[model samples]
Target chain A: MRSYRTSTVVALGLGLALLGTSAFAEAAKDITLLTWLGGPDRKVLDTLVTGFQAKHPDYKVKINVVTSQGDARGGMRTALMGGEKPDLVTNTWPAFRKELADAGILRDVTPVWTSKGWDKSLAKTWRDISTTGGSVYGIPYIFGYRSGIWYVPADLQKIGLQAFPTSYDDFLATFDPLRKAGFAEPIAMPAKVYAHSEWFETLLMRTGGPGLVTDLGAHKIAWTDPKVAEALRQYARLFGAKCCGDSKLMYATHWDDAADRIFVERKANFLQIGMWINARAISQYHLKPGTDYSLGKFPALGRGFDNASIIDAKEILATGIGSNPDGADAFLDYVLSADGANIIAKAGFTTPSSSVDASIYDPVAAASVRFVNEGDVRFVLGDLLPGSLVDEYRLALQQFIGNPTEANIAPTLERIEAAAARAY
Target chain B: MSAVDTRLPPPGARAAHRGSPGPAPGRRAWMPESATALLLLTPVILLFGLSVIYPVIETLRISFWEIRGLGRPRFVGFDNYLRLFSDPVFLGTLWTTLIFTVGVTIVAVTIGWTIALLCAFAPRQTSIFRLMIFATFGISEAVAGYIWIGIFRPGDAGLLNGMLSAIGLADLAQPWLGGANSALIALIITAAWSAVGLPLLLSFASVQAIPRSILEAAYMDGAKPLAMMWHIMVPLSLPGARVAIFLTLLSSLRAFDIVFVLTAGGPARATETVGFFMYRESMTQFNLGYGAAATIILLIGVLLVSTPAIAQRTKGAK
Candidate 1:
């Protein structure tokens, strides 16, 4: 009888030990995160992950850095389709987010959002974009003002400009003195798809405010609107006046090359690009922001319209179909917490929904914040379009830049509209 | 007739008497000798089925559907085909691919043939030259692309442009890769440069194996250098030239890596070939069904154009 009782006790002890070890193993799960965070951005993300791991001490986060934006979106789609999805993914464009939601790869984060009371921390516009079908699907990570121009400080000082222009007339007037002072080209305009689109979008916003692009993206307004046509005409006039470099040269060049010419060669006094371009310039050329160069909102078009621009949030990390829901929820909470936001902000990057103090930023970020707070900035137009329509627009822009004409513009716009209609 | 019948019966009986007479010499010659041959061939046949035949069949099957790498494939019949006709980018890529193929094939084969001839006829120093030229074949296509990119970069900091400027030819410093008109040409040059060494080495080996007696006899007959090259050497080396040209043509038709790394079908799609377009559709856009359709189109094009040349070369070789 004693032997039997001891045997039973031993069996129970073994079972309990096995269960405890399995639980510990389950708690130490490794999660894969797909992101485009490399270089300095990668270092920053690694620090944040380290912090999270220190607090949890049970989970392991493995990050796979995708080299390009295109690859990240395409790879995620392929992975989800193959049922080999990552635990978390970062996507830049809203179209991708919508596509993932439509495909049911994204977990509905509404409950998590509500449980965590994340709504109290996020802006309404950001929250609206993150929600689909009245349910939250994604969280915004980093945000930047897209429609802006960079100018060399020396050029601005030489031209007797005290500060960046706040209105369109003053913007053109500043260029006139630069042109008269023997600066053959005052701006370096790349005829790339995104570059040209940004130029046109900035011009439209300056002329008619952010409503024009927003309406166009929402299909409430046509591309052949009179304001758009006038904007195109103005773009052509600027091209003819040599206010920008050769369109063909620009079309053939990458954005980085254009940035290099502005920053290194001093061939052009100004360049219009996104904040990511600023990051690239600073990293590549070792230039000090606000000292060697300065940032300004894209020049305004007319008096009635306020200084307006476009804002684009970088991709957010979200749970995929194959993720451990509980662990993913924990990570999401960590990301939304004040600690995570502070870590990202201190690394010289901006989080979309985070309430970061502007005083801590460099001059460019501070200026970008001022513009976002004051100007009527809308979301990027292409990001708002359907994926198919975005591709169509990119192709159309390429074609237009290759052979820009009054005769070609209408047909190109018509083709794009037809494509957009079909997509919808 | 009576005598012949008698002899045939006698011969059959004699062969039966000679211990099966090596199992009828004709059968022995027709069949492979050992099980090892079949064993070795099995893996090759299986690989051919899996890599070559299966993908072709799967691509054709998927071309008829509306599959986009995600979800179930929906049969769309002729819609995908109809869309191909209407796709302006596809049309443009087709033309560009054709131009690139013809241009690269002609350049590579001609240059390779010339180098082969030099290696065959030139002095001992020509061996060094041959080795140097053949060394390029050892380099990967990606490395070749980067080397050419460094050479053809448009800025004043570029190697070629800087050299030209130093030589007081600053006026000649044009954007070699910065315009639609020049981008394709630049890509073709890089492709030809990267591909020349393979054909050159192959042709050189074939030329070296040519009977020296034939060449000596030609020399004895007072054949001039050009006459020997054009008439005697070329006709004899036709087999090698044929193989070289066929390889060059195929490589140029399917050229992807160099163009991908260097131009990526850019400069207003001037360098966009069918291969690059298919890659973008499948890999970049995640439009697998469309990519499959494009791939099917490319396979058909290659087969239709190349089969005849390959067959003719094989027949000539035999």
Candidate 2:
């Protein structure tokens, strides 16, 4: 009996030792991600995190979501202010990144980029866009072409256009024919908020190219510059073509309603928006890409920057306040890995990392990839603009849509310029 | 003890101090009336301080600093207030708020009082109708805004436009929320619809309080129904209607959800109220200091509207 008790005590000691070791191992730091992303975006982040956790079993990713009604940046700022010390944050707005950087909330990841040899996966241009004040703070993982126009192929056939228009004038010329084909509006302008500004932004890209976006965003070039005026004049030409319906109808429409007009009601022909609409088209409407709907590049304006495009990209930034910088850096490296990019592509998104398997993209997403690869790309102008100026700019554009005339353009530009001056 | 001696002490007597075993264990000993009152009010006062007073004080403090996004704040004093007054957008919202508040109060109170008087004549028959009207008050303002969106939608698919077309008035059928004037009118109509319930219930209660003797006397005097309604019921029910006007006016001045969902202060901001302006500045732009200044102005406006009503209500109260 004494021998048996002694043996049992030894066994219990071994078991307790094993449990204590495991408890120590499980105490490894968790990499918390603070984001305002929801729906499909949350699903994508969750997938990437699962892949990351699988590769690094010692680390776990905890995603903290900041919910808001509109303009999620407010909620994000609120979360940070409420003492959420997340290791990583997903940012889309360049201005917001600057704000965070200025506040010293972000860590300069320039050294990590070189130490990890990220240059092999991401191009120099991505690095350039991710930098502010000559220091890199984030890694842009996913991008969407903002310069593409969404169209239903069958509807184009009705207007006697065998394919989407390839030139500015040709695109405008098709409007009359589409209207003649029993459509009330040729192009649905969602002027209720900011989508109405999309056409003008693309026109600006065509007229003044990427340099203008950079200069205007920095307030280096005034809003009254001839280059900016020329862009607005080109936008006015859409009104001249009678491309959209009455100003009243345009003012009443939002992006979703315009999408409905294009897909559900079949009352309108085209909409220019970001790539989320592709997901919406496939998932919400249950439509096939390239067959039911397709995307075309904004028609060429015969400008020097005709080959250039605009895109919206989401980047992951490291925070200084995090407890686990090593884990956060490892996660960032994993995000740009071949496995990570492929996972993103398979989820119906385009990744900036060239390590992605190109075959994973659907035809429409493939087209967006092709168009973006064709030339230099800039972040969408709205995302580049300061928060204070963005609203006034959108409101001015909204007012312009109310009366899209040459007379209105000057006042509109002047109004935005005044706001910009104060904004800077 | 004798019955007279054992009788309860007169009100405010120090009964507990007389011979109360120094009050039971774990219970309070004798205290002055004011001390007892203070003890009773302590929790409520603390709660009020935390939820209401603290926020107001913090907001006032924030108004003095210029906080832009995550950037460090700078003390700007009253520059933000100065900027708001000079701002065309803020000034425009003030004008719009006045118009919306007055418009909603008149429309809701007038319709509600009329219906209440009409229902009072046939209380049993109109019970379901009264319930149906009051049901709208239970509906959330945001939900009501969404329902109105379908009605005021731009196209022929919209309910109002379809009804107009069905009635051979297609020429008059236009996008109800597209134009500045029309959008504001639609918002007012929706708000009034949501607000009409309270006035109806209040006025009905007032009308019910009319003595049956007085009504019967009027009836015996051969006074017509219209004469009784105009001379007696209308004059007597003014108190309830006045209260309704005051309430609806305050609610309308602070309208945001309906505006946000339906119009978003759009078509050149013709429908923006001071409340929406505050939200846009604070939440959207992260102009905390500027937004806080706007909030303070709105608080003052509310106080101005409420102080008179509160004074009149408490005129003879202890």
Question: Which residue segments of model 2 deviate by more than 4 Å?
Answer: A1-28, B1-29, B316-318
True contacts kept of each: 0.33, 0.59
lDDT of 2 by residue, A73-101 (tens): 89999999889999999999999999889
Query: Where is the poorest 10-residue window by lDDT in model 2 chain A?
Result: A21-30
Q: Please list the C-alpha lDDT of all candidates, in the order they appear.
A: 0.73, 0.89
- Report the lDDT tens digits of candidate 2 across residue range B1-318: 565667655444454556533444345547866787799899999999999999999999999999889888999999999999999999999999999999999999999899999998999999999999989888888999999988987677688988999999999888777788988999899999989998998889889988888888999999998999998999998888888888888898888888889888887788899989999999989999999999999999988998898898888464
DockQ of model 1 vs. true complex: 0.34
Model 2 reaches an interface RMSD of 1.0
**TM-score of every model?**
0.86, 0.92
User: Per-chain TM-score of chain B, candidate 2?
Assistant: 0.91
**C-alpha lDDT (0 to 100) for residue A400 of candidate 2:** 84
Q: What level of docking quality does candidate 2 show?
A: medium
Stretch of 10 with least lDDT, candidate 1 chain A: A66-75
Writing each residue's lDDT as its tens digit, candidate 1 over B158-229 gives: 678889999999988766776787888888888888878877887787788889998899999999988988
Residue A34 in model 2: lDDT: 97
Error of 1 at A35 (Å): 3.8
Judge candidate 1 against the unseen true structure and give its global Cα lDDT, from 0 to 1: 0.73
